[model samples]
Target: MSRNTESPVDVDEALTHIDSRGAKIRKEQLERTLSQLQADSELTADQRLAVERLSERLVDRLLAVPRASLQDAAQNADEETIETAMSLFE
Candidate 1:
């Protein structure tokens, strides 16, 4: 019997692995990344403040809608909403 030895994976670099983990897992990854960025020692005071503001905005947006409704909107975005989004890019 032959044993196969493979190198350990860097989970963050594996796109397919990340995608397979679904929304909750991806949310966790986003939080971990944000925390890591916030803790970086080299950021200037202004840069840190900007990151803090962005983080607050992210929290606000996430809490603006209930999870079920957000999921529903994502799965069934109405034509009017789609058109409005398209117009923004035009």
Candidate 2:
């Protein structure tokens, strides 16, 4: 009979390591993007701060609500609201 090469614990550990690495990479990317946005000379400091705060608020809302609730809210949003939100991201 064929035999397993690795134990289930080993597989779980490898997956945990992969997840940690992915999270670290995402955190680094977010830091770089935030730095770039804050360093933009075209925007006043206050404007840059406002943009950052708006992003943080959106993140807070996401964390506060269930995924389905957020999805439903997005789906139900009117065209003007959707366009405004999309434009802000762009």
Candidate 3:
């Protein structure tokens, strides 16, 4: 039997592949992708840092949404839940 010797995938390489697709992924999808990359055992220290920074940027953008908009979207939701969501930015 022939043996396969392919190397494990790198996080940066995976990111490059995703970026090359040129399709806009939703924030939640991107967050899930990044979380998967972060969990990869082959990730180097730099790759882990990059993944963390990207996650932070995503969270920052999410938290930047106007409070009024979030409130409107979550109509019927309790005020405490809305405030808890907004507090993630702080």
Candidate 4:
């Protein structure tokens, strides 16, 4: 018989795993892009600080919402209301 290697995933655990994987990719990209920017002298201290702060805020916001609820709201929303709600993210 073939052995199952995977643990049964709970919804929250699954989401957490997905987020962890995405964060790894994002971290690598950020490191590479930031190194390039530093090499090119493209960013000021204030700009770097602003980017760090905004990235923190975005991670906080993402963690604040349940994925199912966000999906439901987005799917059910009418266009204008969705646009307004999306504006709040910006």
Candidate 5:
């Protein structure tokens, strides 16, 4: 029998949520996390991309939950999400 290690076919994407009470705090935390991650030479491009995607996707949800920094939130995040949001938005 063959084994399928991936998520079920119905699961189109996986999401991670971050929480923060203040917009300024959330922005600072997200920026710090992104800058740190972007600077890391040890992480692969795909790994960074996935994290960025998850962070961008969860901005709203992140602001909803009880106060939590994306620094902590991103750490708790699953380390991967859906697509790319790294390209400069023109």
Candidate 6:
């Protein structure tokens, strides 16, 4: 069976594409969460500044996660979220 270059049957390519899609989705979700935090009415100036800084840090950290295992990346992201939530009280 001859392989078609126009139609990829490469397993690695398919996995790479899937992982790329998942990372895109996670990035969008993070953006939405940050937007919600920024739009909240009750936050004081310092709280808002803290959230904005944290949001930027999250974006940086998220971009650094390996693309091959997005589920694990997301789990680690959830840990960051938990840490951020806790930081609000401290």
Using lDDT, give the best candidate's number: 4
lDDT of 4 at 52: 66
Give one digit per residue, the lDDT tens place, for model 1 in 57-82. 66546533433333344456333333
Clashes by residue pair, model 4: none
lDDT of each: 0.45, 0.47, 0.49, 0.55, 0.42, 0.49
> Model 3, range 1-90, lDDT digits (tens) per residue?
223365432333333333333223444566676678767756787876676677667645653444444545355534444444434333
lDDT score for residue 26 of model 6: 55
Instruction: Write the number of the candidate with greater TM-score, choosing between 2 and 5.
Output: 2
- The clash count of every prediction, one per candidate, is 0, 0, 0, 0, 1, 0
Give the C-alpha miss distance for residue 22 in model 1, angstroms. Answer: 19
| Local lDDT at 81 for model 4 | 39
Weakest lDDT window of 10 consecutive positions for candidate 1: 9-18
- Best TM-score goes to which candidate? 4
Q: How many clashing pairs in candidate 1?
A: 0
Question: Candidate 2: where is the Cα deviation over 4 Å?
Answer: 1-9, 41-90
- Alpha-carbon shift of residue 30 in model 6 (angstroms): 0.8
- Higher-ranked by TM-score: 2 or 4: 4
**lDDT per residue (tens digit) for residues 26-67 in model 6:** 567766866787687556778756765775576556544433
C-alpha lDDT (0 to 100) for residue 63 of candidate 2:
35
> Which of the two, 4 or 5, has more TM-score?
4
The all-Cα superposition gives candidate 6 an RMSD in Å to the true structure of 13.6
**Candidate 2 per-residue lDDT over residues 1-90, each given as its tens digit:** 223464312322333443454456545655787678668756677875776566566554543333333344455643333333333333
Query: Which portions of model 6 show Cα errors greater than 4 Å?
Result: 1-8, 41-90
Residues 18-42, candidate 4: write the lDDT tens digits. 4665466557766776788789988
Q: What TM-score goes with each of the models?
A: 0.31, 0.36, 0.33, 0.48, 0.30, 0.37
